[model samples]
Target chain A: MLPILIYGTTLGFTLALIAIGLSLVFGVARIINFAHGAFFAIASYTLYLFFITLNIPLPVSMILALISTATISVVMYIISLSRVRGMELNEMIITLAFTIIVIELLRIYFGPSPLGVPSFMKGGITIAGYVVDMQRIFIVVISIATLAALAFLVKKTRIGIGMRALAQDEDAAMLIGVNREKMCIISLAISAILAGIAGVSVTPIMTASLEGAWYALLNGIAIVILGGLGSLVGSLIAAFIIGYAEIIIATYVSSHLKSIVALIFIIVILILRPSGIMGRHHEIEERV
Target chain B: MKSRKESNKNIRTIRKERLDRGARARSKDLYVLMSYEDIAYVILPRVLPPLILLAFPFIVRDTYWHMVFFLAGYYAVASMSWDLLGGFTGLVSFGHSLFIGFGGYFTAILNVWYGVPIWLSIPIGTLAGAAMGTLIFAPCLRTKGVYFSLVSLVAPLVMVGSILAFAEITGGEEGIYGLENPLTELQWYYIMAGLVLLTFLILRKIAYSNFGLVLQAIRDNEPSVKVSGINPVRYKVTALFISGLFASLVGSLQAHKLSFVGPSYFYLSISVGIITMSVLGGVATIIGPAIGAYILTILTEWLRWLGGLRMLLYGVILLILLNFKPEGIYRYLERTYQTFERQVVEE
Candidate 1:
């Protein structure tokens, strides 16, 4: 039971880190950004290359991954944003295609085999006759710190206010000279950096591979759907719900059915409540 | 003598008039005019392309590679069917493998348990697929866009799970095999080729028809279609049913070709592959998906040397294409062909 609890917490924190970026992107951009998983996988793989292949220190490797992923996200935004314009469906399709390309490129270069980064903390802590790995504890800590930092940045910064305005109304924000494109780029960069940090933090525990894109994508989609499309708090809450549910299901039922079970939950939730737990009724205007 | 000469002249003129009318009717109805450019650019090239493709197996002489071509042909047909519903209708079903899997399973079961001949089982499977499509997707036509896609995606996953759970009938995860007919591989290739050609012709006709136009209308705007006095739901359901028919036919052919059927044949990735082919070929175009399928299949076969990197390549290429050429490769080819024809006509 203790093992399950630790595993659930570890998974929930990792998922929250991934979900926050997606929620931010959805809130500001109104695009699902299917390439979120690709960015995550790329960041994880970059960390693996830096730490395992190049013998870099874990902290430096993690920072490098975050920076590189941010740059790539900026490049992606520049390339796709103009073409997709105001069309959310086009944005979704373009991102889906982008994901395919990124994953394929990784497979071509790194050869599809799973790569792992060495755990930063080598030991564990004992609590009430139950021991928890130090790496798992680190994941939980970093995830909380990152989430707190993100919340502070969004609530207290000028750029965050601009992002909020843009999310509410792009044209209105532009009329006030909010620099919509710059804001979008920044949002994408922040999202990518968050995903990168998550990738680096979780790589030691989960390992990294080309196949990570689909798994991460599924979890991200499920969390975003369950939490609400653009609600940060909701995403955090939904991540835990899903993470715990999946871990519990895998333990009680069969591991192979985990994905199917999660998908079923998503379907049921979507049918029953499309707006999700914290989502409001949104008037979706036809953009294109 | 003067009256006889006059009558002969009149008779000759009347006969000549009749012959002229007959020739005109034949030319108008049967001998469609190929514009000089069309003759030079499209007609000449297309007429012999099939013959050339047919001659390929003869030249290669390797049965295994010929089998690969046959498989490619089947996939081309399946992908095109997917394009018709998902691309043209904008339904974006992620559960198309359900139709294909059902078709294969039904055909195998009918052929094995009931001793039904292969010829009779194929149509039965096709109808079953159409029925399943109506049952699953027709009701969801009221739901728009992502909702429809989400439902369709879940449908296949559920089907697979149900198939696995009911091991008594479906043969479970291990899959069903050993149902082979007495036909040789060469005969099967010919059968597959014939079916592919038939499917292509049928889809081309559908693309040119008013029904196809209505499907496109429904895709572009459902409310507008409804306001225009056309039932968008009916048209969407029809498109799904037609797509299912073709998908099932191809699935049945696949079962016959492989002499084995499995759940993997109807997995999510297969649906993803179909969507990839459809989008890569230029959605809403009749021939684009087939070309997309053929190119991807060949690319996949060649990239086998890279092991799992082929899928990665597929993803990357899809992204690049989506960014740069949302209209797909076929649109570019069509434009080039049109320009060449125009130039020939001008010359």
Candidate 2:
């Protein structure tokens, strides 16, 4: 029981890290970045390619992989999201379009298979009679640190302020000299890089594969939508709720039904309260 | 060399820039059919494609290409429904395979378990599909576009899980194989082709009618539509039913043709491919999805040699198409061929 609790918490934090980026992108850019999942997949894929396949140093490989994903995100932003900015349908369609392209590219190059990644840290420590890996602990630490840093960036930095301004209103932000395009590039980069880190960090636990994008896409979407499309606090809370629920389902029932938990969660929440737990009820009407 | 007589005659002959016969004919709606050219313009586009598609089996003697053509017609039907539901009706479904898979499984169950004949089962399955789809998605109509899409995106995934959980009946991952096909391969092709043409004509007529206009208005602004005394819910539900009916119809056809029904029909890729085909063909154009599906199915067959690169190129092609001309190939052609750009008089 304790093991399940510990595992669920770890899963929750990891999801928080991933969901935060997705939430940020949606909040600021007002576009659902479906290709965010492809970022997760390719980050781990490139990490595998650079670190193991090409025999590069681990740190260098990680940085290079993260950089590569960021580059793709920026390029994707310019090509796909930039022109269709502020329109929900166009944005969603373009992002889904890029997602297909990215996931397909991953499949073509990777032979539609899952590839393993060696652990960043080895060994385990017992906590409450549950043996937990040091790498899992490391992931928890990294996620928390990343979250802290993101909070700081958003609270204290100028670019972060610009992002917040843009999220609230693009025309107003531009009027205040926020540079909407620049803010978009920066926010998308951060979002993509966070996804990259989440994927790379979690690689030791799960083999990176083409379908990882699908998993991340669905997970991120379920979390963000349930927590309200653009609310960070809501996403964080919703992530834990969904994460624990998913883990519990996997543990108690069949793991095959884990995705169904998210599916059901989305449907239930969408039907019951589209604003989510912490979101303003009247921000956007349930019906458009 | 200019003469006063030539200038004066040219000015007089111009007659205040009156429209010639061809120009006048072009100005009138096709319904008028003012001349032979007008009749050709209206009838050619509608007749030629279907004729070519009907003649395809005879021309493409290769078994593989025949299969490709058959699949093209199948995909055309599905994408057309998607274009209607999404592009025209403003309900963007990210996982439309729910209807397709539902159609396949329900038809399979009805035929195999209930001893229903294939002929009877198909229509029954389509009706069941429509009813199930409308019942399930009708509530979601109250939600915004994103939430509606979210429900759609997960509906198939849920279907898969439920199917797997009930593996005893669903056949689970292995799926039910060797269902009956009532017709021979050639007959199936011609029949499917006939169904495809029939679907095209029906959908096109509906799209241009007052019903289609109301649906389009709801897509633009539901409140305004409601203010104008139309229930958006009724139209949205109807659109879903119509769309699901055809999707299910084609899906059942596919299952019988393959003699199998599997959980793979619930795959999101099927939905994605349909959307890609619709967008490539040009959304809202009644026949664009059909054209898009044909081109894509053939493209996939040709690109099979590329192996993994096939999908990469496919993705790239979609990116190019969506980014450059989201209206799709059919609409693009329609605009180019049908549109006139005569200069306006200053008055």
Best by DockQ: 2
TM-score of each predicted structure versus truth: 0.81, 0.90
Tens-place lDDT digits, model 2, residues B148-227: 77678767867887788778888899888877886777887887789888898899898889999998998888878889
Candidate 1 residue-wise lDDT, A151-230, digit = tens: 88899999999998877777898999898777878888898988888788888888898667766777777777677677
Q: Which pairs of residues have clashing backbones in candidate 1?
A: A97-B319, A100-B315, A100-B316, A101-B315, A101-B316, A104-B312, A104-B313
Model 1: native contacts recovered, as a fraction? 0.31
Model 2 quality (TM-score) = 0.90
Pick out the ten consecutive residues of candidate 1 chain A with the lowest summed lDDT: A279-288
Clashes of 1: 7
For all predictions in the order shown, the interface RMSD in Å is 4.1, 2.3
Model 2's lDDT to the true fold? 0.82
Best TM-score among the predictions, by candidate number: 2
lDDT, candidate 2, A202-274, per-residue tens: 8878889876787888888888878887889999999999889989998998887888888778767867886
lDDT of model 1, residue A219: 78
